[model samples]
Target: MSNNTSNACINDSTNQINIIFVGMYSFISIVGLILNLIALVVFCNNGRTRSHTVVYMTHLAFADLLLILTLPMRIYYHLGFTGLHQWMCNILGLVLKANMYSSIFFLMFICFDRCLAVNFPMSAPVQKWRKKAWLVCIGIWLLTFGASVPIYLSKPSNQTQDKCFDSIPVFAIQPIVVLPTLFVGFGLPLVLMLICSWFLVRAVRRSTVAQTNLVDSSKISKMITTSLLVFLVSFLPYHATLLLLSLNRHNITCPMLDAHRYSLMVACVNTVLDPVAYYFTTDTFKKKVDMGAFRRMLPLNSQSSDLTRRGRVAEDS
Candidate 1:
């Protein structure tokens, strides 16, 4: 892939855009961070979280929290608030990449765990699977760390007032490096998550028929399905654009740069969008939110479910 000299040449316009991105990230990161943290606290305080799903929710919160922790550096980096230094770039890139990949892997884990629980509910209690599940989560983090370390180890670039530059050799952007990241970070994980969610939905539907006390599991299924779909819908476009850009770098023109920037912005949106996905997918989070604790922690107001129910009933009638 070839880099466009004009695009690579960062100008006042580029700086303005980056600043705007930082602003957006700041708002998103703070909101998502606070919500996930509240979820974590509620999980700890409530005794209702002994289920396997709640355990997964805890780890999911940790992954998201780790990602949120790194957002300030990213915001600063894009804002040009930080000194453009090699170590800073390396460290920031490493932490961000690690957390991102870890989150992706954990999404896969949650989907798979759900699938397993639904498919094998009669064999053994899910709590017995908890220890092994944690081990698997740790293993996923280590594996993702291994795959993502190169992003940090790669040479750093400096963004000056006059221009944006990478000290790393241009050849470093070769398909070899780019392809692996696209696969590990986007492609493979996307495929695995989709497969797992599919199986999970099917398993849940099948198992629900055998369980007598369970209400219709459609709500839970919808939550998982929507979460995974959001991940796909939000991230897939960006990855597709990146892959196209990677493959046709030599011919990319100035007009395309605008689209590329937008795509990058979309990819960055994941930093904010993920918490919404987490809140929807995890039951413990919904319960806490329903109990008004979530609104109490934030400055938001909670409307009563009774009013909502009345509205729903009127609509249905």
Candidate 2:
């Protein structure tokens, strides 16, 4: 809780490490900004007809955007151009937790939704159900923001110090913050997602679903890939590193701290990936999002069945 990242910790870490951090954020911020904005446009293009998946995916993009929009503040603070205030540290802590947990929860829901869509293709998609789902999404926003507040209790004042220089503050380093969130934020959601993936996998195996036109075979494949792959890539490494970070809090060496920091950079990759991966039914996805070269790397919508598409997710009404 006391800024475990001592002055020696920071100085011992090479300048090359700092350069990599800045370089990664510089690229991610510029490209992630443009992609996420376009994603918002695609998700909200037709509010009247936006489906349940759209609702969940909208929140996902929105959460990442909150983090994306604020990256410059983080970058400047890290680069030592600005000594971040205690108040700003608290605020950024909230924003960081809010983005990570909310996105985690939303991804779990999206997986469940996709499962239901594929499983219950003909089951009536309750209009009221979609309406009520928005309440759950709102609750997730409130829950993540609210829950992150407690960890700040353990942080040192650092009121007169370079608050920003303590890069891995209570949020990442404290057992109180890292442990519970690792369980609830990443572990629980990941377990739930794995279950959802299991069901969806069985659904995908049923080649009969494709022949009847009961479901869009390609769509099912896209949802499964996006939900599982993104959830893992965005969260798994960071949380794993965070776990190590917490266990080794007292003995946090330079390399371990650097590894944890790198995990964060990897987490930011989701922003660039989300537009293509999250929006399965987006109308203007291909038209407006000029990601053809990038799209090849991401292989969304290409149905390679038998390994292709899940569940009675009521269609997006």
Candidate 3:
């Protein structure tokens, strides 16, 4: 009787969590798809606007779109449709990881772009970097695609076909691969973003023109804060759980697996958060995609006016 009761409780919790996951992914994928489509339309229509920030953000949006495509399959699986083909799993897994890594790379470059423009407004190399950013984004795509190849080659030995995206085989998740991905892919980018944000703040404070350009300065601060919050909130727990996966690669537990899945949901939440970055960081996004338009899509509208108002207040001060 006791064992039966325990099993029933575990199952009840699982069912509730599954419902949440399904609903969460459904909402995120839908809104993310629409927002990213709008972003691309705006960027494409932004003729003659060759801003470095736009270049990085454009790629970031593209990456997000690709990543969002995989969410439906996840929702399908969560709905008890687990008999998916291995090839389909391989392809979705590859695309999902490739874009996930690419999104983070573009995010890192976006931070660096802002920091460079503010801190080195005169260097010839920096001036030339606008053109170079395109090449860098292309390279980011190639690198992430290459890095994620293992997912295509290695199949999940433990779980059935329905268990596609939830876990990976321990052998496939080699320590070398996992460690580097955790440190270099996530850790290094996080560190660089922090350092760049610090430099950006200092440069803004010391700017000879800052007294007159308070609005731009506030915009910079808001952009940095929004980007960092997105990164830390979405990516941090996922990577931390990823490391834990490595430590207990051999003796995995059900709770640990659940934690890993939940962390990944958090990361996917980045797709929605990316638009917030767009609103705060890019002038084109701010002016072209009005707060009212963005709000009609979601509650991000509530934040838009507050940010704009605060910037105006700073300017008035």
Q: What is the C-alpha RMSD of each candidate to the true structure, in Å?
A: 6.7, 6.9, 6.9
Which candidate has the top score in lDDT? Answer: 3
Model 2 clash count equals 10
Pairs clashing in candidate 3?
82-162
In candidate 1, the residue pairs with backbone N, CA or C atoms under 3 Å apart (3 or more residues apart, or in different chains) clash, namely 2-249, 2-250
TM per candidate comes to 0.75, 0.81, 0.84
Per-residue lDDT of 151 in model 3: 54
Over 80-114, each residue of candidate 3 has an lDDT whose tens digit, in order, gives 66568767777887887788889999989888887
Candidate 1 lDDT at 217 equals 58
* Overall lDDT per candidate, in order of appearance: 0.58, 0.67, 0.73
> Between candidates 1 and 3, which one is better according to lDDT?
3
* Tens-digit lDDT string for candidate 1 (206-247): 655324343235554665666677677656776676666666
Steric clash count of candidate 1: 2
Where is model 1 poorest over a 10-residue stretch in terms of lDDT? 308-317
Can you tell me which runs of candidate 1 are displaced by over 4 Å? 1-8, 12-19, 46-48, 77-82, 125-130, 156-173, 204-211, 251-261, 280-283, 290-317
- Candidate 3 regions off by >4 Å? 1-17, 156-159, 169-172, 209-215, 291-317
Top-TM-score structure, candidate number = 3
